[model samples]
Target: MNGVDPLGTGVPGPREARARARAGTAGPTAGWAPGHAQANLIAVPADWAYDVLLFCTRNPKPCPVLDVTDAGSWTTSLAPGADLRTDIPGYRVWEDGRLVAEPADATPHWRTDLVSFLIGCSFTFEGALDAAGVPLRHVEQGRNVSMYVTDRACRPAGRLHGPMVVSMRPVPARLVPMARRISGLLPAVHGAPVHAGDPAALGIRDLDRPDFGDPVVAEPGDVPVFWACGVTPQAAVMASRPPFAITHAPGRMLVTDVRDEEYRLTL
Candidate 1:
C-alpha cells in the first residue's frame, strides 16, 4: 500500500531511489521510496563489531539492527544486489571518533576489516502514517526530520557508550495517539513515540537548534513527538571515539528491498 499507495494516493511504486543514490544523488531519504524498508548504516572495524552489536542489543529502541554484513562485505539480505558502499546517498567517515569526511561514495574508504550494520529507520513506517491521515511536516516542507541528543544515556556495551538521540516530528494534538499506534506496529523501526508533549521533558532546549537534521515547523495544534533514533550509534561514535567507522549521513538511509508490511504487526 505504499509504493502504489494502496490508499489510492496514486503514488508510483518501485525503488528507483537506490538507483539515483547509486548514481551519486546525495540527500536525505525521508520520502524517497514509499513502502520500502529504509535502514541506517554504520560500519566499524572487525574488532569493534561485537561491541557495536552488543550496544545495539542493549539499546534496541535506538538501534534495531536489521542486518549485519561479514567483514569487508557490502552486500546485505535487506537489499539484494545492492552495494553498501555506494548505494546510500551519503556517508560519514570517522577517524578516532571524529568525523573526517562526508563522501558520496564510500568505496574509496571501504576497508577489508570493516563490518557493517543495517539498523531500522523511522522512514519505513511513514507511508502507513500518511495513509492514516497523519501529517509529515518534514516531507511536506521538503526538509529533513529534526533530531536531538538527550540527557538520557544508553546502556553501555563493551566499548560503545553515549547519550540517546531522538528524531522529532510535530503531529496534531488530536492525532498524536493515532500516530503513536500506527508507528507502534513497526517495532523494528523504533516503534511508538518516546515523548509527545514538551521537548524539555527530554532535556531538548531549543527546537530550532537541533543536534542533527533540520528543524521542522509545526502547524496549529501540532505537538512535538519524539522517537529513539538510529543516529544514537553515531552519537556514540562521537562520544566513545571509535578508531574508524562509517555511517549513513544523518537523515540519509539505505532503502531496502523489504516491504514495509514485512515489519508491520496486525493490531
Candidate 2:
C-alpha cells in the first residue's frame, strides 16, 4: 500500500483499484495491489447456476470458485463494500450466448435474478513471480496478458461445454523452473504451468496473435508458458450460448480483500 506496485509504477490498492476500475480509469489489475488476490467475474441467471457450478467443479483449474453470490445479489464476500455491478474496469454482456455489449459498468443490465460468481485468477500468481524476480513482459509493456483458446476440451457439465483457454507469458528459459515452483504454491490461483516451451503442442500456431488480450514478443531464450485461464468460463458461456450472461473483460478483474498468501497451499 505504500511502495510502488510490483509491476513498477504506483497503482491503487483494493479500494482505490476498484474505484478507478468503476470510473473506467484503471485499465487492468495485473500489477495493481500486488499482495491482494484478483478474481474473474461471471454472472448468470439463477436457472443456470447449477450447471455453471458443475462446470466449475469439473474444470477447477480454469474456474476455481472463490465465492458465489446469492441470486439477485451483486455483493460478494470477497469485497463486502464493493458492488460487482461497477467495480470491474470493464464487462461483457451476453445475450443468447453472443456478446452484445462491452461496457464500463453493467448496472443498466443488472437484474435481481442474476447470480454473480468470483473465480480465482492467475494474476495473483503473476505477482508472486514478480516478487521472486521474474519479469512479466505483458505487464512490463502495459498490456493484457495473451490468452488463447486451445484444442483441448473441458469436460462438459450439463449445458456448458467449451474448449480450454490459457494465458501465455514469456519466461526466461533459466527462470522457467523457478516460475513453476513459485506458482505451484498457489493452487487456488490456477496453480502451475499447464504447458511450457512449445506453443504448437497446445495448438497455438502463432504466439503473436491471441484469442483474447494483447500479445507480447517473446525474446530469444524466452520460453512460452501457459496456464489454465479463468477466461475458459467465458468461452464456455459463448459456446453454451446461455440466454443471458455477464463476464469481466479480458484483463479486467475483481480486486478482492483476500491476500494472495491465503491461496498458497502447503502441499
Best by lDDT: 1
**Candidate 1: tens digits of C-alpha lDDT, residues 23-105:** 87666788777878999999999999999999999999999999999999999999888899998989999999999999999
C-alpha lDDT (0 to 100) for residue 157 of candidate 2? 99
Q: Report lDDT (Cα) of residue 154, candidate 2.
A: 98
Candidate 1: segments with Cα more than 4 A from true spot: 1-15
Best by TM-score: 2
In candidate 2, stretches whose alpha carbon ends up further than 4 angstroms from where it belongs are 1-9
How many pairs collide in each candidate, listed in order?
0, 1
Candidate 2 CA-lDDT value: 0.89
RMSD of each: 3.0, 2.0
Model 1 TM-score, all chains together: 0.95
Angstrom error of the Cα, residue 101, model 2: value is 0.3
Measured with C-alpha atoms, the lDDT of residue 30 in candidate 1 is: 82
Candidate no. 2 TM-score? 0.96
Please, what are the lDDT tens digits per residue for candidate 2 over residues 1-267? 223363344665798888777777657668887789999999999999999999999999888999999999989998879999999989999998899999898999998999888998999987779878887888777778899999999999999999999999999999999999999998788999899988999999998989999988877989999999999989999899999999999888999989899999876
